[model samples]
Target: MKNTYKVNNPATGEFISEIEMNTKEEINLALKKGHNAFRKWSQVNAHERSDLLKKWMDNIQAHKAEIAELMTRENGKPIKESLGEVDYASSYIAWYAEEAKRTYGRTIPSHNESKRIVVTKQPVGLVAAITPWNFPAAMMTRKAAPALAAGCTFIVKPAEDTPLTTIRLIELAHEVGIPVDAIQYVIGEGKEIGEIFTNSEFVRKITFTGSTPVGKTLLKNSSDTIKHVTMELGGHAPLIIAEDADLDFAVSQTIASKFRNAGQTCVCANRILVHENVMDEFANKLTTEVTKLKVGNGLEEGVDIGPIINEKGYTKIIAQVNDAISKGAEVLVGNEYNANHQINTYFVYPTVLKNVQLDMKITQEETFGPVAPLISFKELEEAIEIANSTPYGLAAYFFTNNYKTGIFLHERLNFGIVGWNDGAPSAAHVPFGGMKESGLGREGGTEGIEPYLETKYLSIGDL
Candidate 1:
């Protein structure tokens, strides 16, 4: 509806810049250009494509500081975290550059006497992505790098709240000799642009990262064209603490997992499942650490927590906190919602809730804010049951010193990723996705590029 997208610093609610929204006509033209580019681009040798991607990766590192600052301003993440994200984003490019050369094909022995069968991978054609604002830079490259490396042209519609980071990354790609039309972006109302992307016959595949409801809409829209789709949807991750776990190590890892990006990440610990035996100690240590975190503008020095993305996010977080409190959850730290605690309209206090019930909204829904709800469990089986209670099976974490317990949890967690005695488990080299409603396809690792490619079976008769 709006003709311009106004970018702002979410931390201070300051205006940054305004970008013109792309119209349906313009989007269609870009789609045609992307389709035309894909014809020649897909024919290029994998090694050449790899070289260009490596150049792109180098450019990202060279301008890391500038890009990191831009990301922080738009996404409201701490500057330190933004810098880490920049590195994480670039790693995808670097990895896919090398992985481009390894799209290996295999030969199968034919059952027929004189026939040979071979299977080969090829680019899936024009790919369209819709990325969210949480990890702006990283999410984009995670999809783009692999698509480009696989020789598919990409066009993305980034989240309206955080388009600047995506725009800057695409500029870097162009600077490194990447074809403008081969990798492009569109900024506008998501519904309109997304509809165009899904309806267009030229777009052969669609990759999306956002809420489950939206992912379902896209999935339904793309069905008419029967396009290949990759959905990295919502996650309600649970971090379990076993009775025999190292208390100090568990506390530190929980801090790293729960508080990073002010607890806005999809894989961030949503529920803290602590063993009842050590609940008081874990709760006390976690509360002390949370109190020490400084909440302010992300650009300011020594600030650990930043503002929530917008007023809606702030409201949702507050509502969840209230629901938990009313339902008998004890506040271990940060339940104050007064002007004295909040630096701005969108700044939420880093909160930790103990005795959190499974029925509370905070435990059931994905709270994308600076809040951690702790739920106590009596046994390993009960913990597993509680963790698997949600429909989302994206990522689960547990800290256990026992070999048997660790192995059992790992096998029974039913998530795409399981962190054992580790809080931050994601890396560019491993497959990242979720099970069930969490997501539909993998990103990163060798599997990351597979969604961008299609396999062809060749049978040579009388060979």
Candidate 2:
């Protein structure tokens, strides 16, 4: 049966769109198409692929407003954040477009002058790029843009909750003459879609962004056939505020990092560790700012944030909040859902929590909500220890004016990406990914495409 999946409006728990699921035969057909396309597509010159990426960026720009709105509709992020995600995603196209031509090959001198050695990078054939719902379009493009830039044919399966925007992106690419199945999209539940991608012999690479447990599962599956896998998994990020940190800046940034997208981000600051010297001021300022954030429907103007994605995410967030309270955590600003308060009928309150313990359910696990736990530390050593305590080593943020402390923390933190004396926008030109459970493989700049490609060595016997 060709079952359909519906995208639900989180605030109202109403269906937004119904997407058709590809059947087993259809999945096989897509794999066949990808296999056929990869041979021809990967054989094309790098410059040609770069040119198409440029065109794709332009196409995305042309439909920026519509695409961003659809993202907001599906994921319930503020329109501004959605638009920012689109702009950021466009930059990925531009980045990989330039990277495609700049770093492709190498030549190593042999022991004898008569012999020469050459090493060149080649695409990994068909890649199945699976993306998560939060920052849906950007995640897909981050995975697909690099694979395509590396000359690989892609079958993109975006999260079921937010596939419309990305499906349209594939359609846009087709409009720009990238070919019909060169970048196909499968819109269905993870189980069905992933089975096809992992089990198919023709699909050689799997590029994914999602939870760590799921990443582990996929990694195991890919290993069964020895297929290449690039996974961007979950993170429980920690933000530390040193004793000398600017309390105002620390508070504002903490709220922003923790609650952005209603706290659905995998890299969101899950723990806030503040030195005891600044705890009172930090907590006060943070709660004040969190209190002022205008949480409403994404389509409305001036709304700083929006609802959690789907009723399941919404319920999960509420459950975490209630559990936090029952376990001795106190609400600083928001603790209840204002269900009667949706404009497009999709909205949630920005939440803040204090007096949270390290063993609390919300503290240990990812609540993926607007909840921010205000934790206190007495010493720099303790702060660093607490930050690295979590198994996830994705991204960690720290605020400190002391240069020595900043340098020490930067070197000591276990996270893959570290933000110095501030929150997690390290840079766009730099690489992004984690070290441990967070994920494997980079996602930006020159390093992004390295995961989607392989290098081959050739030697000339008698030059």
Candidate 3:
């Protein structure tokens, strides 16, 4: 009486294959194995652990094309983006491998002459890493790399829609000396796997990347066991354009950031705030850029945008756009679709909306599509207010020529990360997370490995 789910190619809406759900007993077994493995894995030499991670990274790089193809086939992201994700995932492993060598502790000065205080870090024990489908390969690996480097075993439950890439990566991990129990894959319902993570005493940490609602539920569940958790959830990033900034630069960067992965990214600019003096000019430029994009099957060359993940996503995006238009928002480009196009049901025409109001659904929610909603602001204060209006504070961007303006906005923006005149500010070596409801904790950079570790203090006194 177990449930099962079918996978689909979002572009063609073709049925792929079905995967059966893992039962409660099976999940418990995986957790037990992980707990047992952690006992031995935690004792491995740090340098030797780093060498093993390097091998895994090298193996992944060797099959980069294969990994990218599986990701695009399942997730409907452009092949180019898939390839980039694979490379980025591998880079995380490499970075964490080096970082493993430097998980250093410290000695503290003591007031008493005969006292010594020292602190060290140890693995947080078995982890349950739940990743979303958006960046199939990167999200899983980004969490897995640090978990393994910190000597913690884990069970990766990738989204049901996109499990192939992560499954293959786990297979590679085994080939590169990672023990089978040290890295396990469970492809099934989020509720089932999440329940296992929450109820099980073996799981010491939960690293999740998904919606804010789901993250909140996981947080509540983990509280039962008082488990450590890191979450990177939804975002409603705002891109502000100043009157004196270069119009072309702002337009191009916004287009690239907002439309990447068809605007499915968590850090995409959901609201665009432009100075009233240059609002008209910026809208026209953005319209021109949106028109130039090519939307089609991800595997096809020159296809700039891909289809929505499923019918639900397609319906939601269309409704949001329609609601905005009905509220008197002007559409400079792409409110219409070509019904004659055979794959039209799965495709959402990339849209650009101007004269957007704060009350509009498109402005209030994370559009999660290739839709651009533009709003006008007369002063820096107004721009800051609009940008911080959302409960979510994942990321924000602004273009300004004045040093004082840049400094002022940077200080006032209520976001975890800021992009100054640039849209994509994330990197493997830089910490990535959000503030407020966007979710808790951080991933990547020097702080990336910290979540997997727990600090221990030792004090010595004269006999």
Candidate 4:
């Protein structure tokens, strides 16, 4: 089977390219190159590696506008939004450039007068980085940046839908003196390509960002060989509103957070659990906010929201909307799909559903769209109950004025990352992974370097 796939622009239903798939034979060849490259790449000093990475950074910024256009064309995200992704990605390259210099060795306390103990971090080997379509630049950087900084080579297989930008990036890295085979690109069915990584002995570490069920499967695959794996998987994140919260701020934040990228974000708000005291007020404000949102081509100016990723996302969002409506949830703003100029473009209206209950699929499932289902809670305990009711534990947000309430939920949210009185995620300096089925390990902050490296201990005795 070939790893060939076609990329489409959902906003305008445009065809980008039909990528030639990598065969198993090609995968083996890449693996061989990755292994050979790893030995040579990892042997270089930290300063040399940092300088090489700096070249890649300069190249990325030099082609920022073009790269963002490629991203938008492939992923259906707004051009400006895609630019934001590239900007964030550049920061990661810059971060890793500095990190390469800071990867340190440690000295252990001596147990005997004539004995010395030492510990050091070394790159494991070739890293297999599998990234998803949502936030392609960020997810790619999260894995590739740190791994490269730790002196590891990479075999990056970006999601089939949005592989052009990634392929361009890998090519650019090669152009800047990073060995061609040091970073390989393969685009295709995620499962087919993933097996090539997990079953191969040459791939020393695996970093994946995608769905939960898929993450578990990857975890199981890597477990048989005990290959190092770091997963940044899916989430059905909840946004909680307390009675004492600022209704205006909470509504604005939720709309922005959830509707960003048309609500395809793994950390995007899916379920809205508002306190009973201000449910009506919040709903009214949310309706006005959502109704006023500009929905058009991603490349168009003043477009607040864009189309979903692809046909599968279109079908999923349609099904979820239909199910919610049939179950008595009222649509307050936009409903159904919007086609442009008689062509059934992938544009979905920013949907708002009220009278939602915990039993509905919209609340239980991750509605990867611009639909916000409203759930009311009579008390703080009830809000917490609804928030933790899902199977995911990726990211959750709560708006509350009471310090006690914020602290209480902060400790009991059953989530890996939480935001208080805010909608954006934690800084890139924090450990960014989730509990339960969300993912396997941390990606950023100080904890990120450990996964890319293996610790070695040295003990010296009297000679």
Highest lDDT model number = 1
Model 2 per-residue lDDT tens digits across residues 1-463: 5798777765555568888888778888998999999988988888999999999999999999999888887887889998998998888888898888875688897999899999988988999978888888888888788888998999988887788889888989999989777899876778777877888999999888998988998888888789988888888888998889988878777877888888889888988888887787888888778888888778888988787666667777777778878989888888867654333343458777888877787777877878888887888898888888878999999998899999999999998888875565744467999988888888887888888889899998877
Model 3 residue 208 lDDT score: 97
lDDT score at residue 398, model 3, on the 0-100 scale: 95
Greater lDDT among 2 and 4 belongs to 4
Question: With candidate 4 superimposed using the best TM-score fit, by how many Å does residue 35's alpha carbon deviate from the native?
Answer: 0.9
lDDT of 1: 0.92
If both were scored by TM-score, which would come out higher, candidate 1 or candidate 4? 1
Residues forming the 10-long window of minimal summed lDDT in candidate 1 = 336-345
- Candidates 1 and 4, the one with greater lDDT: 1
- lDDT of candidate 1 at residue 119, scale 0 to 100: 100
Q: Write one digit per residue (lDDT tens) for candidate 1, span 295-409.
A: 9889999989887887777788999999999999988889655332243337788999998998899989999888999999999999999999999999999999999999999
Clashing pairs in 4: 3-21, 4-21
Candidate 4 per-residue lDDT, tens place, 1-463, comes to: 4545667777777778889987778887898899889988898888888898889989998999999988888887878888988878877777788888888889998979899999999999999989998877778877887888899998888887788889888888888998887778876578987888999889999999998888888889998789999988889999999899999999989987889888989898999998888989999999999988888787888887888776678888888888888989998988868755333367788988999987788888898899999998888888888888877899999998899999999988999889898898745567889988898789777787779989899999994
Q: What are the lDDT scores of the predictions, listed in order?
A: 0.92, 0.83, 0.90, 0.85
Q: Which scores greater on TM-score, model 1 or model 2?
A: 1
Clash list (residue pairs), candidate 2? none
Candidate closer to the true structure by TM-score (higher is better), 3 or 4: 3
Q: Rank the candidates by lDDT, best first.
A: 1, 3, 4, 2
Residue ranges of candidate 2 with Cα displaced over 4 Å: 13-15, 339-348, 426-428
C-alpha RMSD for every candidate = 1.7, 2.0, 1.7, 1.8
